[model samples]
Target: MLSICLIFFYILLIISLTLFYFSMFFMFNDLVLFIEWDLVSLNSSSLVMTILLDWMSLLFMSFVLFISCMVILYSDEYMYGDLYMNRFIMLVLMFVLSMMLLIISPNLISILLGWDGLGLVSYCLVIYYQNVKSYNAGMLTALSNRIGDVALLMAIAWMLNYGSWNYVFYLESMKGHFEMQFISWMIVLAAMTKSAQIPFSSWLPAAMAAPTPVSALVHSSTLVTAGVYLLIRFNNLFINTNLSKLLLLFSVLTMFMAGLGANFEYDLKKIIALSTLSQLGLMMSILSLGYPNLAFFHLLTHALFKALLFMCAGSIIHNMKNNQDIRGMGAITLSMPLTTSCMNVANLALCGMPFLAGFYSKDLILEMISLDFLNILIYFLYFLSTGLTVCYTFRLIYFSMSGLSNSMSLNSISDEYYIMLKGMMGLLFLAIMGGSMLSWLIMVTPMMICLPFYMKMMALLVSIIGGYMGYEIFKYKLSWELFLLKNYFLSNFIGSMWFMPYLSTVGMNYYILNMSYKIIKTIDQGWNEYFGGQSIFYYSKNISLLNQMIQNNDLKVHFYLFVIFIILILMLMLI
Candidate 1:
């Protein structure tokens, strides 16, 4: 019965989303309208106008909704008997709603609200188990997100105060606000945090405690992409700023760091988590090159393939009876052919194999990097990260599906699981073809197109080499340097970040409570000395007796004086 209801709900959501986009198609000009609530007479037309509608939002929204719908369906079977399935579905609905709102928001405020809403929902889903570890991951996510939220809030406040609350106001007011460099930097900080950029990126790997569907949605399609979306939405603001260059540097660093981490991680989920971060870095680097459209395109393709990959991971874990250790299983490809096939497609997409979705988009990004002469370091980092991505992808595929393990018994993958796996694989296959179709229609026609065919070919060759290298290297003993670096440095760094709130909150609470206790004790001692042991009744009696004695003495004095006065008066009269 619950499964039927969930399906119906998803159908309704899809209908509504389809209607929303179709409406946009007819009233496309309305999208440019920047209505100002504060103004009555000053140019009642749209505050901002741009005919930027294309395959970007359309493609992204299509895949996002499609994957979301599939995930909902898959969860029906995966989470069938779970007690919290209803609650999970509700959160998923809210997450989808927030992402849609984000996609259509015309102004910064709307986008920020959507961003925060998605963050909150994702955190809730991450800790859905309500276990200590899950709660810890949720708290860590919240803390890191709060840092980003603060930066965004500051930027919003600055914009409203100095620039504009509406689109026209922003455009009109931006000319004189070159001095708002601080706000720009703040915006970058916020973007870095949202996109899981360095130093602030530790929360993502920890967030793997979430259910895989949550991982698929939050890590791949929606939550992390919010950062890249922000940068794209405000491309005008960042066009000529030094912040753009800073973004490039930050992105390259994030790519290298996250890729290296992914290379070392043995846990399937953590490897995916780190890869998501690295891919986000790639998107950021593309955005920094002033290619918002290209970045959006890449984001769409990444969303499709990454979500599929995570779902495939989820299916594998489910078939394995929740055993997530990659080393525990091998040579199960024949048993779980559906999962094996889907994973292979996703890995190809991830490794940027030729004709794959990742190939087209990632190739473009690298081409842009090379053409811009930005920095050789950026190019090296990009290539190195690509290689690491390949290594980890193959590592996951090989360990999870290939090789031989004598101790493990193969379980037949269920029909329901196969359907889900196939569904995801089909989507990836479509995404793999989408890039070429879009490029032919959108890129090849424009003489202004700057993408180099040679670079694209080179990237494909590198990806192929990287994949083979990854397969070859998997047989060797694990690198000791990687072990020490990951277990001692990277893991500890991420783990410590996760542990910070506990230590800080507990320590702060202890100090506060201790100080309050000392104050209470001092007050208690003072009260005891002043009033607790004193004889109040005795003091009151003493005061009453003193008052009575004074009154009686006054009366006696008056009577004696009156008598003496009367006698003296009588004697005077006689005389």
Candidate 2:
């Protein structure tokens, strides 16, 4: 029964994707009609020829669907025997539907609707375990997303009020307008929050409390990437504002900060969580530089490789009875040969090793950076981040699969868990060789100038050397003190930042409710004492005789009564 349902779901997904891609292709040729509707009428208009379909959207959609499909397949084994399996699968389907809607949406409203839907389903999946920790994580994710949603709403409101609601209208009307610049900056803020860029990024690492499949889905394809997709979709709006430079600065900060966090993280999932933030920063930097194609290309490649890596990590955890601490695992490579191989390839790809999907896409961004000095600074951050990625990836893999002791191998790893591992390996293979095959498709636009073959080769060499050196230096354990700098201020700051939201939330709730309760109680006591308790009844009784006298009708008496009644009514109203 489950198999039948899964098959039907996939069929619907494939059909929808096929139709959508075909429609997009036709749109590129100016052959598609814009369907506009009013309350009583429908209008169709022709579109102008566009280069939007050159490669970026196509490649991104392919990656989105591929990772999503693989995640679904892996979940079959990962969630096996779990009672909520069907419910889990449902959330996965809904997530995919939302992502597809987002990727194909032609305007900002549609994209935001899709984004909100994605957030809803992702929150459901994150808290699917229904435990306190999972609930906390889900709430944090929702709260952070609300910040982005509100920003988006404000930006949309401004655009509408300024007569630029529609994409075409906005493009036509926003000529040298300073308000548009402000609107663009707000949108960038929205993107940063959604992408889990720093200051707003703590939610992501906490989100590791979710299941591995949820982690894979988020880190690879859906929720986080939606922000980047939004940026690419609105690339023209961003080009004219300082928002681009702001995005670059934030991206660089997020990349380095996340790298530092990854280095200190002990839990395997948290390490990957931080790494996801770093990779997102890299993608945003490329996009900020107006290289949407390159950013999208890297986004796709990152999705494939990262999902594979996460799924592989999930399988290892499952085999080890849900253990996620790297320190607890060691020397399992000989026992879990297949899992080790998949993990190694994924780590290499993630570290941007030569000939992998990451190599082509990452180097493309670096090539763009070489054209300008500011870009070079951004690329330098990325280059340094590559070293951190290697350090963390190797730390994880080596701690899990390579060490010199039998004490580390308590339970033999299972081949039965290889279903997800095999799925990941399949993705790993594609990530390793897929870029060369897709190079022609990605290089069609003028933005994609070919780098010298030797330079590309040299870039590959540097990445490999960086990875190797990172492994050599950090393979053995080091003192925690080595990580602490200047009285451990920075680490303390990050830790506090992670906990600040929860602390502030609890503190604010207590303060407001407790303080309000005390103030109200004090007022009640004062009223009781002043009026001898039962204040309303006492007031009513005392005024009853006076009210009756005021209502009595006699010429001169009534005139005086009317004046008193008016004053009484005014006092009552004021009270």
Q: Give TM-scores for every candidate, taking all chains together and pairing residue i with residue i.
A: 0.77, 0.80
| Candidate 2 residue pairs in clash (backbone atoms < 3 Å) | none
The model with the greatest lDDT is 2
RMSD of 2: 8.3
lDDT value, candidate 1, whole model: 0.72
Best by TM-score: 2
What digit string (tens of lDDT, one per residue) describes model 1 on residues 1-575? 55653674478447646743654463444344333343334665434422223344544566667777767766766676888777888899889888876776655576677778988998898898889989978887887888888887787787666545343246435643753565667767887888888667777877888888888888767888888877776666666567788888888888877776665566778888888988999988888878887887788778878888888888878877887778777776767776778778888888887788787788777776667766668888888888878877887777777777522554655535644654575466666786676556445454343656766466666666777877777766466447656578556554343343344345537788998898777766566545654556668879998777757858777787789999999999999
Off by over 4 Å in 1: 1-59, 162-164, 168-176, 410-419, 440-457, 478-575
Please list the Cα RMSD from the true structure of every candidate, rounded to 1 decimal place: 8.5, 8.3
Report the Cα lDDT for candidate 2. 0.73
lDDT of 2 by residue, 151-174 (tens): 878777777766435554565367
Q: After superposition, how far is residue 479 of candidate 2 from its true place, in Å?
A: 3.3
